[model samples]
Target: MTVIAQLSDIHVRPHGVLYQDAVDSNAMFSAAVDSLNSNRPEPDLVVISGDLTDEGTVDEYQKLRELLARLRQPFVVMPGNHDNRGNLRAAFPDHPWLPGEGSLSFARDVGQLRLVALDTSVPGLHHGELDAASLAWLDDELTVHRDQTVVIFMHHPPFMTGIPYLDIYGLRNADALAMVLARHKNVDRILAGHVHRSMQTRLGNVPVLTCPSTTTQIALRVEADAQPASFLEPPAYMLHRWTGRGQPAVSHLCYVGRFEGPLPFA
Candidate 1:
């Protein structure tokens, strides 16, 4: 089985403060990284969905690179509203698939899965949208890799999570994205971040999952007028296990900190 560990919304700040002193995102991300590296069955790869930095600043991206350098497994990143494409490309020059300008998107093959990173960030805007260019590129890529199971990773979810405050900042062109996704029968799952909460839903037969942030989690308030608030819930990440062909992919939500376990179920 190919184990792909996913961490999202790390939100590391250059000065080490995030969301108005709610949590130290850098430290939390470090802890999460350690946990993943030390996992009993080490993951084959790692994917950070988005929001690697609280602010899309040079200093912030530098710090994020430093933190990610400690990771043992190979990793890839996408862009969120909180990220700057230019800064990311500058920091990771080796990622040739990342365009120097425009949306940062790429595809990589991980075992039996074709991992596609889609950039949904809109410059100077909090809301996200997959533009025509990006959708077209994705369609072509899916067409070329029709035989491989595709798992899409993006910062913003294509579906609303019922939290009115956050929903306003969700993917603005979800219908367009759904249309592109519908034609791709090989798309196995869509993994996203930005909600800072773990969520599960579907967009046209494809499973979409949002991972919780490594620092804080958005409070689950479904009221129409609900406001945005975050809590110091245990930071977590998601592990996706793909067992080659003829088997379904499985995802597990894992908490970062330590807990007593494996002490004999009998």
Candidate 2:
């Protein structure tokens, strides 16, 4: 069995600042890293979906790097709308997967699973789009790794989550992405961030899941004109376990705080 831990929207602060008004994003993220590091059975890898910083600043990224360095398992990160591609690449020069100056996209093989990271951030906008080049790269990568179970990682959810305020900034070229995914049968799941809530949906035959932010969660309001809002809900992360071929993958939403439980039912 191969287990992968997914954490998103860490939103690290510059120095001594809280996200929104209540969330100490830095503290929450530190706790989350500790949880992942101490998890039983241990995860093979950890993937941070995106939004590593609140403002995509150098100080924030530096702090993020410092905090993540404590993890025992290897970790990989993609960029979100709040991220600057050039800064991210500079912060991690060893990450050859990141291009010199374009969208950061690449594929890595771990055990029997093929992990594909896609850059959906649209330069200067909060909304995301998969440009022609990104789409082409995804298609080719999926085709080349057609025999292995592929999991996609990106910053944006390709489907709407009914949160009107958030949806307004949703991915713009979801249909185009769906077309590419439709041709690829090896894609087992598409993992994403930016939604700041735990959500599950389907894109074509592939399962698409969005992880809750490690910093804060957006309120789940469905009104068409709902305003942007966030809550101090307990931060969480996701664990995905693949039990070899022909078996369905299992996912668990893990809260980042300690809670008294696991007591045996009488």
Candidate 3:
């Protein structure tokens, strides 16, 4: 089975923007969809990495759900710091992803491959955590699917990306997470969001992929004094291709190309 499409930090508009990056969240999401729809090999699944709503309000979640409903295929989701679990459940009451108690933990089968979604959203907090329950569930899920290639999704980056701002908000219980992963050999990749920028690293031998936000992005600043986040770039998504065979899973950083001042797709 081939897995494709990942977008994050849609940060819906008319909402709050306490921090930096003010790129009309709605426009960013629109551009992200345009990029996805125009792609040649359309994705089988869209895994939105998190930050579905900016203010974590019921209205914002409703709006966010409506926008996501416009997508062409089936999609799974988790939450970032910006998302409120109550609001998320209220928006998509009928969704199978509902009732996320700090760990939505979705286990669905798409062909032979298994997709698992883990919740890292902590109420009223910026940093993320898995807790013991989520980690235990993950362990159990992988225990059953040891032979199949499983892909895990969460909102917080488990590995460091060098950006101080994002690094501080990285997964808090990463060691607990790593211990779980160390026991499971079936996990193919760990897909994450929340950095608002693209980053990649390895946890042991497992590949960890961080997709850029569908809204604005933060510049890669390894400098001591970095400017607050900027909104100079367009939105984007990620595409993961996995055909259960000799072929390995592949991921793409898809540019949604949506921004305040736009241009044509080349």
Q: Which candidate should be chosen as best, given TM-score against the real structure?
A: 2
Count the clashes in each prediction.
0, 0, 2
Model 1, 1-266: lDDT tens digits are 78899999998898655655666789899999999889868888899988888778999988988998899998888788888888988988877777778888889888878899999999888898988999999999999999888899999999988999999999999899899988879998999999999999999999999999998899999998787888899999999999886576899999999898868876
How does each model score on lDDT?
Answer: 0.89, 0.90, 0.77
Model 2 lDDT tens row, 9-56:
999987788876567899899999999989998999899998988888
- TM-scores across all candidates? 0.96, 0.97, 0.89
Q: Between 2 and 3, whose TM-score is larger?
A: 2
What are the candidates' C-alpha RMSDs? 1.3, 1.2, 3.6
Q: Candidates 1 and 3: which is better by TM-score?
A: 1
- What is the overall TM-score of model 3 with all chains considered together? 0.89
In candidate 3, what are the lDDT values of residues 104-186, reduced to their tens digit?
66788866778888988788889988888888889999998888888888899898777777677888878888899999788
Q: Which is superior by lDDT, 1 or 2? A: 2
Q: Return the clash pairs for model 2, or none.
A: none
Best by lDDT: 2
Off by over 4 Å in 2: none
